[model samples]
Target: MTCLKADLLILAGVICLSLVQRGKTKTPARVMALVMTVLMVAVAFIAVPISSMNTLTAAQDITAKLNPNKLDAEIEKIAEIKPVLLFSPKCPACKEVTEALAKLDPKGEKWQPVQSSGEAQEGVKYLKEKGYAGEVSYHRYAGGVPVLIIKQNGKITTIYGKENIIKAVTAPAK
Candidate 1:
C-alpha cells in the first residue's frame, strides 16, 4: 500500500483502540491519555527519515545554481585559491551549489570555481582564457559539489557550504 494509506490506517487503529479502552476499562482517564500520547509520539518519531534527509535537502538547493555557459569565469576565480569545484551543468544539485558559491563573492582571494564540462578541451581553453593557471578536473556526479580546496603555496584546505560561504571565506587565514 501507499505511504499515505498506511498512515491513515495507523491513525484509524489508534482511534479505535482509544474508543474501545474508554468503553471497557475502569482505568483512570489520565493514565489512558498518557499511554496514547506515548504511543503517538513513538509512531511519529519512527515515521521520519532522519539520516539522509539533510543531505538531500542540501543537494536540492545546490542543484538550482549551476550555469555551464558562465562557469569558466567562476572557475578561474576559484582557481586562485585552489583549482577545484566539481560541477556538472546538467545536475540540479550542482547548479544549486554553484549559486551558493556565487553568493559568496570570494573576491581578492586565490580561490576559483571549477566546473566540469563534457567538452574538456574547450573547457580548458576557456579556463586559460579566463586566466586560470591550475589544472581542471572533470566530475560526473550529479549531487553535491566537491569541497573548495584552498591552497596557498604548498598547503591545501578543503571547505564546503551553502549558507555560510561568506563567513568561511572572510574568516582570517589559518
Candidate 2:
C-alpha cells in the first residue's frame, strides 16, 4: 500500500511539474513550485510508509498477536476463572458469544478481552492465519469467531463454534 501511494505521488509530481515547466514564466513561481515539489517528495518518502505501518499495526495487531505463549501469559493476569472472548465486530459467530457473555456476567464481571476492545479481533485473525484456531481436540474452530477462552488455575482452554461457545460461557468457572 505504501509503495502504491508513493508511486501515485511520484506520477502526480511528474505530471504537475511538466505542466508548470511548460506554462510558468516567472522565477518566483518556479522557486515556489520547487519548494512545493520538494515538500511533497519528502512527504511521500517519509510520511507515507510510517502512516501505513501505523495503520496496519493499529488495526490488525498482526505481528504482535501471533504468539500463543504471549497471549497465554497476558490472559493469566485476569481472574483465575473468567471468560475471555476473542471477538471482532465483523464476525457473525461472535454475536452469540457476546449475548451469552452479557447474560453470564450481568455486571460484566466474568468476561474480558484477549487484550482489549479491538485487539481480540486481531488476535483471532492471527490464530486463524496460523491454523491454530481449530487444530486441537477442544477447538473445532476454523477461521471464525468468537473463540471463547477460560483461564482457570493457570490453564488456558480454547472453545469454538456456537454450541461450544454457549457451553463455555454458561459453564461456571472452576
Candidate 3:
C-alpha cells in the first residue's frame, strides 16, 4: 500500500480513538500520529536520489555498456602501492599532516601526499575517480584523516595523523 494512504489511515484511527476515549488517550494517540507523519516524511525525502547533491556523481551518463574488468584491474594495480597518503582539505588533522610532510621532506621523499576532493571513504574515491587501479585501504585505526595507508595482498595497515608520520619518517625503512 502507498505510504501516504497508510499514514492517512493511521491518522484517522488516532483521531477516532481519541474521540472514543473522550480525550483520555489524546496525548498518546496524537504523539503516535505525529511520529508516523514524521516517519513518512523522512522516508519520502530519503527516497529521492542524491545524484543532484553528490558532486562526485558521474558528469555524463554513458548509454553504451562496457566491460568493468580492464577498469577494475588497472585501478587495483595503482591502489596496491606500499603506502599512499589519503587526505582531504576539510580535515584539521590532515592540515597537520600536510604541514609536517612539507617540512619533513628535503628531496620530497618522505611520502607522496595527495590532496583528495574530500575524505569520504578515506579519500579513496578520489583515487578511483582519478583512475587509480588498486584497492582503497579501509583500516579502522585512526581512519579519519592524515592517514598513511598500506595495502598489499589484501592486507591493510594504517598509521594515523602527524605524529605517526614523523615517526615513520625518522625510522629506517623495513
Candidate 4:
C-alpha cells in the first residue's frame, strides 16, 4: 500500500511537471507542481518505507531517529500557538482521536489539524485544501497516525495512540 501510494504520488508529480513544461503556467498549476515536487523530495527522505502490514517497527525506527532539535524548532515554528494534531482520516485510530478531541475542543480551536499518513503526500494536500498556512511536519514525525505534538515549557512531547492523545490533551497543564 505504501509503495502504491508513493508511486501514485510520483506519477502525479510527473503529470504536474509535464503540465508545467507544456505551458500550463497558470498560478494554481504551477503551485501544485511545486508542491508535488517538494512532496516527492520528502518521500525520498523518509527514513523507512512503512507498508500497511509492517508499519509498527518502521514507524518506531523513524520515531527513534527523529532529531529533537530540528523537531523542536519545527514545533515552535508550526505549533507555537496551537498544538499540531497529525492524523489521517483513513485510520480508524485517528478517527477515534479526532472524535474524542472534538468533544474537548468543540470549535476546533485547541489544536491545528494536520493530515498525516505513512507517506508524505497527504499532509500537503490537506494543508492546501484546508487553507492552512502551517508547514507539513509529517515527514519529521511519521510514527503512525493520531500523533499529537505539543510544545510546553520549551519542550516537545510527541504523543501517539488515541488513548494517550486524549489523556495528554485532557490532562491539567503544569
TM-score of each: 0.34, 0.40, 0.38, 0.47
Estimate, for each residue in 1-174, the C-alpha lDDT of model 3 and write its tens digit.
Answer: 144566668767876765566456778777776786687767655543346644212211110122222222432344464345656755666666655655555233545555544444644544444434444443222223455655545765455547765676556655
Clashing pairs in 4: none
Which window of ten consecutive residues has the lowest lDDT sum in model 4? 126-135
Q: Report the C-alpha displacement of residue 122, candidate 3, in angstroms.
A: 17
lDDT of 2 by residue, 25-136 (tens): 5555557666767776786665434454554333334323443234444444542546766665445456555555555554455555342334344544544443333211
Q: Which residue ranges in model 1 land beyond 4 Å of their true spot? A: 1-83, 103-110, 121-146, 151-157, 164-166
CA lDDT, every model vs. true structure = 0.50, 0.51, 0.51, 0.64
The positional error of residue 71 in candidate 4, measured at the CA in angstroms, is 3.3
Better of 1 and 3 by TM-score: 3
Off by over 4 Å in 3: 1-82, 118-143, 151-154
For 25-59, candidate 1 gives per-residue lDDT tens digits of 63554456557667666765554434556754543
Best-matching candidate per lDDT: 4
lDDT of 4 at 51: 67
Residue range 47-74, candidate 4, lDDT tens digits: 4474664555565456666633445465
lDDT comparing candidate 4 with the true structure: 0.64
